[model samples]
Target: MISGLVQILLFQSLGELVSKFLLPTLPGPVIGLVLLVLWLVLRKGINPDLAMVADGFSQYLGLLFVPAAVGVVLFLPQLQANALAIISALVGSVILTIASSAFIARLLSKRESHE
Candidate 1:
């Protein structure tokens, strides 16, 4: 467990350095995650220790949202003031998501039929 955590932190620190020096646009953690994914893909499998650590983290993933929820609560007044715009944006995003998914599925089916 300690080893896995160390491995994760190592990647995160490496990612931070890369982000600071090379990729100014991306967040350190996201770059770290991309690096981790590439590493896993190259290895062709998840390390057992890493997998175990990830499983433990996944179980408590909901806890990660607490901060965001707190932010929403903190800005409740602003949210309420802009409720209409927020609702419209939410609805628009859902509609766009559904439309894009359908378009992609149709394109995939057409490609499969052609093949």
Candidate 2:
């Protein structure tokens, strides 16, 4: 368990290093996740210890939203004041996201079918 945690932290540190030194504009966590994925793909096998650690984290992923939830709660008054605009933006963004995802999936499926 300890080793698994260490491995996770190691992956995170690699991501932080890449973000800080190579791509300062990118979010460290995102970069770290990509790096971890690349590492797993390249290895072509999950390390049992790391897999256990990752599973534990995944189980509690919902808890990760606590900070954002708290922020929203704290800013409720401000959000209420601009509720209409926020609702419009949220709906518009969700629609756009779904449309783009569907379009991309269709394009990928078509390409795969042709191949």
Candidate 3:
């Protein structure tokens, strides 16, 4: 498990390095995740040990949102100041996301049923 974790971190570090040197405009970790996905797809099979380690991390995915939750708390004052704008943006985005997702799902389902 430890080794698998280490390997994941190593891949992440490589991605960070590439992003830093090649594309500083983009985020390092986002680049890292993309590289990791590419590597996994190219490999065509996951290592069981690595898979176990990943599953362990996935279990704590909810905990990953803690920092963002804290950030919202910290910025409560600012948010309150612009509550209307924030609420409008949040609602608009949510509606758009739901509509788009529903549309895509319906389209896919239709295609699948035809097949």
Q: Per model, how many backbone clashes are there?
A: 0, 0, 0
Shift of residue 114 alpha carbon in model 3, Å: 15
| For model 1, the run of ten residues with the poorest summed lDDT | 1-10
Best by TM-score: 1
> lDDT score of model 1?
0.93
The lDDT per prediction is: 0.93, 0.91, 0.90
Better of 1 and 2 by lDDT: 1
> Which of the predicted structures, 1 or 2, would earn the higher TM-score when compared with the native?
1
**How many backbone overlaps does candidate 2 show?**
0
Worst 10 residues of 3 by lDDT: 26-35
Higher-ranked by lDDT: 1 or 3: 1
In candidate 2, residue 97 scores what lDDT?
100
Cα TM-score per model: 0.86, 0.84, 0.75
Residue-by-residue lDDT tens digits, candidate 3, 5-72: 88789878987898889998878878888887888899998888789999999999999999999999
What lDDT tens digits, residue by residue, belong to model 2 across residues 1-115?
A: 7887887788789889999999999988888889888988999988889889889999999999999999999999999999999999999999999999999999999999999
